[model samples]
Target: MQTRTNTFIAITSLFIALGCNQHKESVEPKNGGATEKTIEPTNKVVLSSDIVWQKLNPARGDQSPQAGTIWGNRNGKVATGFLAKFTDGFSSPPHIHNVTYRAVVLKGTIHNDDPKAEHMWMTPGSFWTQPQGEAHITSAKGDENIAYVEIDHGPYLVKPTDKAFDNGERPINIDASNVVWLNYEKSEWLAKDSKAEISFLWKSHTDDALQGVFVKLPKRFNGKLHSTGNIFHAVVVQGGLDYTLPQTNEIKALDIGSYFTSSDRALHSIANTSDKETILYIRTNGSLNIDNK
Candidate 1:
């Protein structure tokens, strides 16, 4: 009887020890490893218009050109953004950028001329893409200063090319009014109930690494809580929206001219709570993949 009792106790203790070990493993950050806290990198940032205005400075190495960086270090290999303001009647001699760039005209008129090709006069809300190694000249018309937002990868340097330019290809320029808006409800990537509209601006010819879109959300519209494994830089072109950062549980009211950047794979949502439609100029680095949840 004593042997039977000893056996029962031993079996019970063995089970208890096994259960404790399993519990410890389950609570640990890694499988069968010691418990550790995971630290996530800060991947979200907001840049209000006021902040951008304060950061405005003359373009580095350029002769007195007003500009401000929105996000990412322009000197780094990652994608970067800048808000450039041109003086009235400003014109540039034929030049080229080392890296391709996409631009959205925020205010005033911009006249783009390629000596070897046709000229395009772009007004506010116009979108254009300047391919790398393509030489072109830019000029600002009208009495008011012209402003535009430029997004690109690598350093922002202006290389002066010879007056002799190539007529091989022309820059892609699209007026905002001429762009066709596609309903977000019909898109396979968006939530079925979403009431937003999107106007695609430009997609890189080489790959999906660079792309730009103009999104318009009606009042009281709620976007899907989506995540893309690409860094997104967005600027509020008109109206306002309430942006929610799911991980931090923080809400921010993005007014016109407000800018924000989301780290790769960060989950977030936007809602147009105002009475007017909210327009956002969104640019992404890397391919944009939408997660339903």
Candidate 2:
């Protein structure tokens, strides 16, 4: 009878031990089987200090910019950028982002359109915006490789390029004869920097619409500050920026290929803290919801 009792107690204890181990595993973070665990910020992912933005190559004939974007997604943050290469034609099929896009052609000419605009030619230093839901078509022209910065609400590409548009659609055409010149030019301040050429892109009438400014703030420019949709995000495609928040007075220095967001309800701006010209692509919208602040 004593042996039976002992066996029952042992079984019960064994079950208890197993249960405790299972609970521990469920609560523990999967940190590559290491005992050390990293605690993420309350509402953010802090990229490593050494994490630099690097140019990504798209497939041939797709917008595979030779010198292009180094970017990040700031979880509902207000911004994103793509440094497109002119050497390789942008190859992705027509697609749309969760938000609208503002673009500035830094060098070479970019062809863009939908069934509506047909082939609209965008030249170097030209800035423009496209609304969400608008089908985008693209190709690069001219000998010089083109580079540009784009700004938009991120987590942008929601669908695969292959499924985004109907097949058999033709590329847009540019009427070299009727190219409407907005007569827009870079900011005088930016011109003096030599490395930077700053110019305002199109502005939106609605609160949630996409808006942006093109800047070639190479070593000449450090940073500029502005409020974007609801959240503030920054990108360092070429050099770097010391991003600061007006509300919190917090500063984050991000390098090339690095990005930072100032959080919702925070007033944020980017500054060129380094000697190298800090090329930038920036966009600001009121809120992603379009109706809400």
Candidate 3:
């Protein structure tokens, strides 16, 4: 009887040990290494006007080409932002972009014409969108050269839209001055003390992930430090600001045409140290959120 009892005890212990071993193996990381770090969806970047201006290249690879790009790499599957410069009298035949794009006229004047629609003239601060495969022509007006910032998902390609008229869809062209400016006093996403106005330029119909807006901050405006879990890009359209990056305690002085990007969940703040009102053109790839801190 004692020998039989010993065998039974040993068998039960072995089964328990085997079960624990199986559990351990199941709980172990599948990669067979330390858990991989989660990739944050945001990207932090800053591009000054001087730097981008110097990076401009002839769009057609000629000195007198109608269009030029400041910075863009459309060969990859990524989002691209480019500053396009069009010379006076610059024009393009009816063409369509492989990807939908948004543009903010930064300088001079731009005239967009569609064979199936009316002509629309866009000036500085004007914002517009061209849907993918929409046919249109663009030209620079007046003696000044036209420069606009274009943002889109890559790879950016131009194709002749000889049959776009058959689709019967109208393009979007809006002058920023005509858009109603809403006060940020009651905005839930901003600090209660923020004294600014905002004009929404574009919002994606597919999702709230993509949007554009123009913010007007009064002189000496200062806002509390806030963090957002969305990728943000801002350009100084008129005045200057001192932007702070909380993580590194670094401050950047952004002047006119200076651009910067904040990664998702980055802690940052912006202040208009200048005496003049500051206008900022901001774009985001996701919904904006404000941190309580």
Q: Point to the candidate with the largest lDDT.
A: 1
lDDT of candidate 3 over 86-195, digit per residue (tens): 66676777777777677777777886656444556677776666667777777776665444456556777677776343333335565655544545343334434556
**Model 2 lDDT tens row, 1-293:** 00111233333443333222322221111222111221221112233344333444444434444443434442346454555555544434565544555555555677666534445556544444455555666567777544444544565443434444333322222222222221112222221223434333334455424444334444433333323234444444456666554445577766544555444322234466567655544544432100001
As for lDDT, the candidate ahead, 1 or 2, is 1
Q: Give the TM-score of candidate 1.
A: 0.69
Superposed Cα RMSD, model 2: 23.0
Worst 10 residues of 1 by lDDT: 26-35
lDDT measured at residue 227 in model 2 versus the true structure, 0 to 100: 32
Candidate 1 Cα misplacement greater than 4 A, ranges: 1-43, 50-63, 115-120, 142-152, 163-169, 285-293
Over the stretch 1-293, how does candidate 1's per-residue lDDT look in tens digits?
00111233333443333222322112211222111221343346464555444223345333345666777666677677777777677777778777767777776778664645444567766766676666777777666544545645687667778533343444566665655565534343333455666665555565645556676778777654333435577788767888775557688888765776656544446778778887778776432222222
- Predict model 2's lDDT versus the native: 0.42
Clashing pairs in 1: none
> Root-mean-square deviation of each candidate, in angstroms?
19.6, 23.0, 20.0
| Model 3, C-alpha of 103: deviation from truth (Å) | 0.8
Worst 10 residues of 3 by lDDT: 19-28
Please state the error at residue 52 of candidate 2 in Å: 6.9
How far does residue 216 in candidate 1 sit from its true spot (Å)? 1.3
Judged by whole-model lDDT over C-alpha atoms, candidate 3 comes out at 0.56
